[model samples]
Target: MKKIELGELLGQMTVSEKVGQLLQLAPMFYKGTITEGEITGPMAEMGITTEVSENAGSVLGSTTASEMIAIQEAYLKTNRLGIPLIFMADVVHGYKTIFPIPLAIGATWDVELAEKMAAISAKEATAAGLQVTFSPMVDLVRDPRWGRVMESTGEDPHLNSAMAASFVRGYQGNPDELAENHEKMAACVKHFAAYGAAEAGREYNTVDMSMRELYQNYLPAYTAALEAGSKLVMTAFNVVDGVPATGNEWLMRDVLRDELGFDGVLISDWGAVKEIINHGTAANSVEAADVALRAGVDIEMMTTCYLENLERLIADGALPVGLLDEAVMRILELKRDVGLFEDPYRGLKGDVDRQQDILSVEHREVAREIAADAMVLLKNDGDLLPLGATGRKMALVGPLATTQDVLGAWSWLGDMKDAVSIEDGMKAQFDQVDVAGAMDTENVTEAEIAEMVRVAQDADVIVLALGESANRSGEANSIATIRLPETQYPMIDAIRALGKPVVTVLFNGRPLDLHGLIEASDALVEAWFPGTEAGNAVADILSGRVNPNGKLPMSFPYTTGQIPVYYNHLRTGRPADAADAQEHYVSQYIDIPNQPLFDFGFGLSYTTFAYSNLELSSDTITKMDTLTISVTVKNTGTIAGKEIVALYVQDIVGKVSRPCKELKRFTKIDLAPGEAVVVTFNLTEEDLRYYKPNLDFTSDPGDFNVFIGTHLQAAFCLA
Candidate 1:
């Protein structure tokens, strides 16, 4: 049927039926029966006779395959309208065979590998009776204290856009295959607007950036996801400007729907619509329903506010019937797209071992390759990396060295039993290494510290694996200070004091304050939650099988006071000129340096690379033309390695101020010993465009500086 025809059919329905389409309740599952008591009982008690199926407009969590099938079957058998329920799960990384978090995957910069990971996740989730995943959270975050940064792609908008498109394509695949047997599930892009720019890096707080900053810094990923055919968009819990995002019509209607042409169902984050009452924006459930419905939020996730008062609002003339039909039609269109209207039992099978063939050996091999690629080498002074297997008595010490903390965060269904720790990975190579936990097995003690120090004295080199736990840096896990916990500091000090060479393998979800550790360790490797095969991948890099080419996705701060520091910040007029200045009126702190512990796009390898003079295609160009910037990168050291040639752009003069540097493009290339290659980046008007005060995007014709460098400061921009 045509979508407008479906809208007309929905428009003729009663108020209760239209509200029922917007209410997505949680299903109550039992041993053998899935009844409507939890949802339908409330409906009947509230005098709301018109309702969908028992499982329609609901989310199911943590159910076995058989149980899911039984519940779905009962829903189909008992419902009057026979609308198939949309089964959604938090398939953040992997469904069952878990991978690393999205930030770690972004470090790989391999779009093909990321897409393969999402495809495998979809296969596993589909086998377990899931029809949708709340995944590919594309919010661009620069602050490390925000706990949800672990779930995003990274700070760069372009890279986040690329990864977002790749993930959607992987999850949805071809529409033809999805038309057959519900071939693919829907990918939901989340936190609809600017949840990442929360004040002080707190989660679910107020976001108060200008509209220009919002459009330029945060909206690219959402736009890319829409273009990639994502069928659902989830609203954030934070308040933008002074209004809660769940109730902001300007964001949902003007920005997302009218501007971006997103016609998909707009779903709210868990209980966010109701929580707006606490945000001081809504007076009651009725008011909340009125606000959200008018703002274009079609689906109420886990919140019965819409079902409770949506009918009353429509009757009281606060909401129009046409708005309700618009929402219902969008929901029904998704149902039709998933083939649910055609075959109600399409994804309701309990026995899906046949579909388990999707998780093949090729998938596991790809996971290993991506995990190896995500590992960033932060510091490798004097060639301490690629440790030879012969005559190396290595001492591996730290609490996380042998633990399963490398799974990272939001690995909802990752098998902890199968995860390999750092000690296990290092043991496969050397036989003489002594493994000692830095802290107490149950609780940290002095004796454990003494043992770690004693073991460090005997070995030729010490390998310290230090990082945060998988649970310390995800949702509801925000930290006020991004420093190392006091418990791990003693072990680090003791190991560094042993006077032997120390290599620190840092495993973390967000960027950490590592000034002391950076100065103490001879070499540093950032293995940010390499998944189940983390150990094997680390062993491969440390043993010279795979070269370390991963670069920092987020800046590592020297102190927690510099919480939101990033490389693309603008230069103020009164910026500090002297590094030794004791006072400044600009954005400078009194005690701490403004520089980061490690800059973004900064990573080291076993070999050295040198960047020579940069050359451009022409000094001037017309408005319709493009420019090519070229630079030569040579491997100056003995061993072969790979380097990421980064290109940034700076607008010297504009109607409004601009960032000091913006990442335009980058390419990762492999080089043999003493080999050199010239890489080029083509830039058009799109790369130079900026949103004006009137919200128009245009590039002013002026002299722009193009920078080609390994790091941000070590670059010469051509005028």
Candidate 2:
């Protein structure tokens, strides 16, 4: 249906019917039928009646093709206006064929791979009868304590925005293809606004930050995703500027709709609309619905606040009829955009190769490539990796070696049995592979320790795996201490004490506190939960089949006390310029060095890269001019590998103090051994812009420092 026809259809519905379209329920309605009226599950307390249950606009967390077909077929039988129920689910990291987590994808620094992963996810989800996915979470995260960092791309706004736009492009495709193609679904960029900045790194905690911080760092990714044509935006659970994001007008309307030009449907995070009452911004469900509608949230996800109160809110003149109609129109228009109105099935009710598409050979190859690309070699001394030396015996020991739970959190549909473990991968390539106790125990048991030590001593080298479990770092699983388990670190130390060359394979979601692990192992690989193909991908890198090229998207804090550490931090009057310069006057810590263990953009490869002879089109640039800065990078090692060329700009003088360095642009380029390439980056006026002290975005033309390459000590001055 067109806009006018949709509007006419909206006009034909009563207030109760319109409100019903905004309520999104779970599978309870279809468990038996509306006649059963089984308000037993989560919907029991929501006061859902027969009418509302039959009329819920969409279903959440249900992705099976037959199940959705059944729900939609049944819903249309009773849906008064004949509006089809839209199906939405979380295709966060991946569907059944899981890929690496968002953090691992970020480590790759390969937007193309990230995009391909999203495309595969969209294709698999669409084939399974899902029309929309809650994905591409663009929250700019810096704290690893927040368990949801696993969902975010990384700490940098630029990187996160690039990944966010890629996900939107991959999921929705172009506007032309998005409608008719079931393989392409609507992308929902979420936890809109700064949900990642939960204070104290606690889940559901209040987020209080300056407008400058929000605009400079947090808002870019959300804005980028919407600009890339995402169909929906999910409201965050935390408060921004003292009001919950679901009910904050400035956030929902002013920033998202007006400034960002997002006219698509705006959704609330699960039960966020009702939780506004707990935020102390609303008195009850009535006030919650009133405030949320006023804030312009279109769809109330998993909440009865709107279902029970929106019509009465309109009766009390708290909400206008036009506003309600506008929201319903957006939701209806989204359904139409997905071609749900044209063919309610979107071509999924017919024959489908569900298993083949979900776990396709081509999709598994992409997952393997991404997993290989995202593995970061943190420490490799004396070329200890690649295991290229002949007659090598690997004593594979540690907790994460044998587990198949490599698919990180939010992968609700990924099958653990399909995952490959480090042990499996190593055995595929090596001759002698000894496996030991992979799970931590209460007491080391002298016999187990003796067995592990014997294996370690007998082996030519040791490959030890260690990290948090799969459930350690996604949503509501925040941790105050991100250290390895009490027993795991001791195991690493004990293995190191064997005097064998120990290689630590770190499998984790967040940037762990790795001060001890780094010191314990001779070589380290940060293999953040690589999905179903985790073992093969790590084997590719570890067995010299693929070179490790990933970098740290977020900084590794020296200790949990050094939370919120990031590379793009603003400079202070007396910055701790020295690594260990702890003085009473300067901003330094007395206990330890004021630096991250693994800095952002820091990663090692088997092949070394050299940067020299930096050149710029012009040393002086104005608002109207674009500077083409080129740097010559050469592979200085014996192996060929990809290098992430990063461009960071430091505004030496500005209206307001800017970050010490902000990543403006970056690209990944591959160079053969001893081969050189001139990597060029264009610095436009937009790259120089920053939030002024008075809140106006303008750049001050003055001296600027430009850093190129991951080893960016060769700084160039610009005017």
The best candidate in terms of lDDT: 2
Candidate 1 residue 385 C-alpha distance from true site, Å? 0.5
Candidate 1, which segments miss by more than 4 Å at Cα? 1-14, 29-55, 62-64, 174-177, 181-183, 345-352, 355-360, 438-443, 578-587, 711-719
User: Which of the numbered candidates is closest to the native, going by highest TM-score?
Assistant: 2
lDDT of 2 by residue, 1-719 (tens): 78888979988989888888888887666543334544555456678777787777888888688788887888888877789889899999788889999998999888998999999999899888898999999999998999999998899999999999999999989855777787999999999889899998899999999999999899999888988999999999999999999999988898899999999999999999989999999999998988898899989988898888888878988789788888988999999899988988888756766646888888889999999999899999888988863588889877677878788899888899988888888888788888885544234455666677777888889988778888888999999998876767667778889889988888888998887788888899999999999999888888888989999899999999988799988888777774555667788888977889889999999988989878878778777888888888999999989999999888887878888888888999998999999888888777888898777887776788888844553333334
Total colliding residue pairs, candidate 2 = 1
Candidate 1 lDDT over residue span 1-719, tens digit each: 45675666665656676676687755453222444465566655433443343424555463345656676666667555666666777888886566778888888776787888888888777767677789889988988999888898788888888889989888888633554655467889988898988888888888899989999989998999999999889999998878999999998999899999999999999989999899999999888888998999999887678877877877888788788888988988887777766665565453545355434566556767888888999888888888877688998888777786678788866677777777888898767788887443224467877888887799998988787888788898789988766677777888888889998888888999887788889989998888877887888788878888888878888888887888888777767764655455666767888888888888778788988768877777666777877888899988888887888888887888889888888788999989999888898877889999897998887778877854322322233
lDDT of 1: 0.79
Task: Give candidate 2's error at residue 109 in angstroms.
Answer: 0.9
Provide the TM-score for each candidate, comma-separated.
0.92, 0.97
Which pairs clash (backbone N, Cα, C closer than 3 Å) in model 1?
none
**Where is model 1 poorest over a 10-residue stretch in terms of lDDT?**
710-719
